[model samples]
Target: MRAVRFEGVGRIAVQELEKPAPGSGDLVVRVEASGICGTDRHILRGEFSSRPPVTLGHEFSGIVEAIGPGVTRFKVGHRVTGDPNIACGLCPSCRAGHVNLCESLEAIGVTRDGGLAEYVLVPEKQALSLPADLPPLYGAFCEPLACSIHGVDIAGLRPGMSAIVLGGGVIGMLVVQLARLAGATRTVMITRQAAKRQLAEQLGATASADPSAGDAVFDICGPGGLLSGGADVVFECAGVPDTVALAPKLARRGGAAVILGVLRPQDRVEIAPLELLLREVRLLTSFLNPFTHARAADLIATGAIDVAPLVTRQIGLEEAPGVISEPPPAGEIRAIVVP
Candidate 1:
């Protein structure tokens, strides 16, 4: 089997490895598709915590090739999407139903061998069934959509509310459509890329803006602006200091701001605590997908969320290392690795 390994900081490559067999209560998935994520780049650069010498692909889906003893929910030949986050059931967070915040959380691709190979072992509980007839490549989006579902849940968006999504990448794009489905009457996407801005509008953003323009803030929130009083909820999806700092500023008074981006552990951002306090704005952060993977699978299988446009390019396992080594190409939303 060929696998893309994250050897260490600033090092990643494709290597031949033995195909995995299912352990007890596990399923061995013959990987169909895996999407390259920003976190993959962060892991390679040592900006995010990860276990090296491991296969590096967290957002992936495949067909069940084999099942181990005690596995009952799945069988060989089932198409499935793997939820990579594994939480210790005994942890305080898990007991409280906040499994995403488990004290002893382990992740596939980050801490264990993942689906960036010919075969990857998935615990039975972590695998969510996908429709057999659905396009295999689209199942790769379930993980990301699940994470975005968690963000939308945290935001508590309501009908007729306004939303501003910062960044036009996969997370940002998924959020745009989710916000509309959540009944957000007005949705705005802010990013530097003109192509992404156009795509966002097509994907249900009521409007779009280029943050690179100096007057974006005033243009969107100032008097006579598109969102004259700012949005009811703002989502920072770029995972950068600038967007983090700008999220709250784009929220209306008494509104909320949700940080869905993953920044480096050492990264810092400047924010105005007094302003947030005065306006009663809630600044919240959404982490991993806690219990939304199933909904993501349903959405993808039913064609409720448009993921076909989200896939910008497709490459083989041989091209995975090089693509992850470099920044995403201009106008690229996602690059799927077909192993």
Candidate 2:
């Protein structure tokens, strides 16, 4: 099998490797499509500290090539994607239904070989059957969509509420759509890129703002500002320190602030805890999706959110190494590696 592997920090290469046979209770998937995620970039830069020689594309979908002993729910040829977060089911977090926060967790593409290969091994229990009619590319998005959904759930969005999404990349755009579908009366999107703002409007954002043009996002979204004082919810999805720093001021009194991005180490963003207490503002963080992969698949299959707009490019496995080293063009989002 041909796989894209992280040779070391600042290095990645596509090489032929032995196709893994499913371990007991495991399943082997024939890779069809694997999307590159921002985490893949961190891993390459030594921020994620993944083991070397590990295959690193996690967002994906494919066919069940084989199943291990005792695997009964699916058979060979069944179309599937999987839960990439490997958790210890008996952990305190997992027992509390917060598997995303499990102390003992290993992720596909991070801690183990992932889908950027012709065939990859996954736990059978982690495999999810895709909607028969959904395209493979769309299936590849289930992971990220699920993560976005989890954030929405944490946001506690109410019907007729106003929301401000602080980014326009794939996750940010997805959050904008989810906010709309989740019943936000006004979902305003902000980004430095004009193209991203346009895409946001097309995806149902009630308004769009250019934060780079000397326009203050916090002031515009919050009290006594452009949109006339604060939104019901403000989602920090850009993963930028500056944007995360602006979150508290963008949310209304008693509103919720949801952090959806993985901030880099040494990046500091401060919030006034005393101010939050006075305003009754809620602060929350969504790490990853837990038990929501099925719902994301349903959303995509039913045309609830169009993912085609987010897929900026698709490359072969061999091109995966270079992409990790140097990202795509500005405003280009969600590049998939077709294995």
Candidate 3:
């Protein structure tokens, strides 16, 4: 089997490795499609925390080649999406139903062999079945979409409300659709790229804005602006300091700002405490998909969320390392790796 291994910081390559077999309570999935994520680049650049000497793909889906003993839920030949995050059920957070915050977390791709190879082992608990007829490439999006679902869930969006989504990447685009489904009547997607702005509008954003053109905060939240007095909910999906700092400011008084972006570990941003205090704003952060993977799978299987537009490119497993080594191409949303 060929696998993309992250040897260490600033190092990643495709190497031939032995194929894996399912262990007890696990399933051996033949890799079909895997999506290259920003976190993969972060891992290569030492911007994100990951255990080296491991395969580096988390957002993937495949056909079940084999099943281990006691794996009764999934059978051979089933198409499934794996929830890469493995939480210790005994942990305090896990006991409290906050598995994403488990103290002992082992994520596939980040901590162990993942779906970047010809085959990867997935614990039975982490495997969620997708429709047999679902496109293989679309199944790869279930992981990221699940995470976005968790973010939208935390935002508590309501009908007839307004939402502002920062960034126009895959996460932002998916968030836009989810926000609309969550009943956000007025959804605004802010990004500098003209193409992405147009894409956002197509993906349920009521309007789009270019933050680089003018004062983004004022143009979107000022009096007589799009939302006039700011949006009821704001989502920071750019994973940058600027967007993180601007998220709360874009929220209306008594509104909520949800941070769904994944920032570098050492990065920091300054905020105005007095302003947040005066406005009584709620600043919240959503981590990994805690309990939303199933819903994400259902949404993708039923064509409830449009994911076709988000897949901008597709590459072979041989090209996976190079794609991860370099930054995404201009205006690229997602690059799927077909193994």
Candidate 4:
């Protein structure tokens, strides 16, 4: 099997490797579609923590080729999406039902062999069933949507409330749809890309803005602005320092600012504690998906969320390394690798 391996920092390539077999309580998934994520680029640049010399794809879905002993829930030929984050059940956080914050978290593609290859191993518990008739490419979106679900949950959006989503990337785009579904009446997307802004509006954003404009933020949140007195909730999905810093400022007094973006580990941003204090804004952060993968699969299967527009490119495993090596092109969302 050919796999895209993260050799080390600044190094990644397609390497031929032996196909894997399922272990006890595991299943072997024949890679059908894997999405190239910003995290993949961060891992390649050594900005994100990962185990090198391992396959580098976490957002993927495939057909079950084989099942190991103790795996009774699924059978071969089932279409499934794998939840990459594996948490130790005995950990303190897990015991408290905070599995995503497990003391020791191991992730597929990051710390283990993942679905970037012709075959990848997935534990039965981490796999969620997808509709057999669903598009192979759509299954890859379950992972990211699950993560976005967590972000929305943290935001606590309510009916008729307004939301501001920073960055028009895949996460932002998905959040826009989820916000509308969550009953947010006014949803705005802010990004520098004109194409992504247009797409966001089509997906569900009530409006979109170019953050590069000097008065963009003020124009939307200022008195008598688009969203006068700011939004009820602000989501920072760009994973950039500027957006991180902008999140709280965009939230209305007593509203919440949820950081759904994953910035480089060493990255830091300055925030005005006094302003947040005076406004009583709740600054919160959302991590990986926890107990949300199944809901995401159901949403995708039912066509409740539009994922077809999110897929910006499709390439073979051979091209996976190159796509992750370079920054995403303008207006690009997700690039799926069809193995």
Candidate 5:
């Protein structure tokens, strides 16, 4: 099998490797599609902790080629997507159903071999059977969708509320849909890319704004910087110093500010503590998918999310190296690698 192995910080190579054979309690999947994530970029740059020489791809789906001993839930030819967060069921977080916080975790792509190959092995506990009608390609989206679900859940969203998502990436796009479904009457997406702005409009964004220009939403979101009012909720999905720093000024008094972006290490943002003290706003952060794989798949299978629009490119495994190092244009929303 050929796999994309992460050699170390700033190095990833497509190397011909031995195929993964199912072990005890393991399921060997012949990967059909793998979604490239922002985390993959972090893996490439060595920003995140990943075991060296590990093949890196977590968001994926494939046919079950073989199953290890005691694996009875699935058989050869079953289509599935799965929970990438392999956790110790005995851990406190796992016992509480917050397996995303599991202390002894072995995430497929991060800690072990992932799906950026012809075949990848994972624990049977992590694999979930997809609806027969669901396309295998959409399975790659489950992980990110699960994370967005967690974010929306943490926002404590309610009907007829307003939301401002500060980035137009895949996560931001998914967040917009979730917020609208949660009954947010109006949703605004802020991004520099015109294509994303337009796509957000199609996905139920009431308004799209360019961060460079002054907009009234600023009054709602940029209160301390240049206005008197802020939005009911502000989600910082663009993980940048400017964006993170600006998030506080964008939330309405008593509103919620959710940081959805992953800040690079040593990054710092200057905030107005006194203003935050007066605004009564809530500063929040959402991390990985919180054991929400089931809901994410249902959301996709039910056609609540039109993932067809987000998939801009699909390439073969041979192209994985170049695809990861130098991605397509900014207009390319999502790319799927088929092995």
Candidate 6:
């Protein structure tokens, strides 16, 4: 088996390694498709926290090649998507039902061998069943979609409400669809890429704006602007300082601003306390998928969310290292690795 391993900061390679066998209560999945994520780049640049000398793919899905003892919920031939994030059940956060905030969280691909190889071991608790007929590539999106679902849930969007999604990457694109499904009647997407802006509109964004054209905040939230008095909910999915700072400002008075983006560990942004205080805006942040993986799988399997448009390209495991080592191509939403 060949796995894409992150040896250290600024180092990555696809090296041949022994295939994994399922441990007790684990499943050995033959990697079918894995999606390259921005976090992969962050980890390569040493911006995100990750244990090196491990496989680097968290958003993946595959066919079960073998099952370990006591794994009765899934069979050897089932198609499944792995949640990747594992929380200690005894942790305080887990006991309170906030598993994503576990005091000691261990994630696949980040801390353990992941699905970037020909085969990866997945604990039975982290594997969720997917439809056997679901497209292999689509299954790879379940992980990201699950994270987006958590963001949407935090937003608390309501019927006929307005939403502004910053950044038109895969997360933003998926957030747009989720907002609409959550009953957001007016959805606006802001991004520098014209191609992504166009795709967002096609994917249910009521409108799109170019952040580089001018002051995006005024253009979308100004009086008589797209949403007039700002959106009911604003989602910062770009994971950058500029978008993070602008997210709360795009929310209407008393509305909520949810930060779904993951920034570099050392990154920081300044916000106006007076402005937030005067407007009474709720500033919130959403982390990893806590308990939404199953719903995400159901949405993808039932064709409720359109993931086909989000897949920009596909590459082999041999080429994954290069893709992860370099910046994403212009307007590339997602690059799927077909192992």
Per-prediction TM-score to the true structure, in the order listed: 0.98, 0.95, 0.98, 0.99, 0.94, 0.98
Where does candidate 5 clash, by residue pair?
219-229, 220-230, 220-231, 221-250
Output the better candidate (1/3) by lDDT. 1
**Model 4 lDDT per residue over 1-339, tens place:** 999999999999999998897789999999899999999999999999898889999999999999999999999999999999999989889999999999899999999989888998999999999999999999999999999999999888889999999999899999999999999999999999999999999999999888888898768999888899999999999999999999999999999999999999888999989999999999999999999999999999999999999999899999998899999998899999999
lDDT of 3 by residue, 79-99 (tens): 999999999999899999999
How far out, in Å, is residue 28 in model 6?
A: 0.3
- Order the candidates by lDDT, highest first: 4, 1, 6, 3, 2, 5
Give residue 327's lDDT in candidate 6 (0 to 100).
84
**CA RMSD (A), model 5:** 2.5
Which candidate, 1 or 2, has the higher lDDT? 1
Please, what are the lDDT tens digits per residue for candidate 2 over residues 90-181? 98999999898888888898888999899989898888888666778888898999999999998889798889999888899899989889
Clashing pairs in 2: 222-230
- Lowest summed lDDT window (length 10), candidate 2: 218-227
- Model 6: per-residue Cα lDDT at residue 85: 97
Q: Runs in model 4 with CA error above 4 Å?
A: none
How many backbone clashes does every candidate have?
0, 1, 0, 0, 4, 0
Comparing 3 and 5 by TM-score, which wins?
Answer: 3
Candidate 1 whole-model C-alpha lDDT, 0 to 1? 0.94
On a 0 to 1 TM-score scale, where does candidate 5 land against the true structure?
0.94
Off by over 4 Å in 2: 216-219, 222-226
Each candidate: RMSD: 0.9, 1.6, 0.9, 0.8, 2.5, 1.0
- Candidate 6 Cα misplacement greater than 4 A, ranges: none
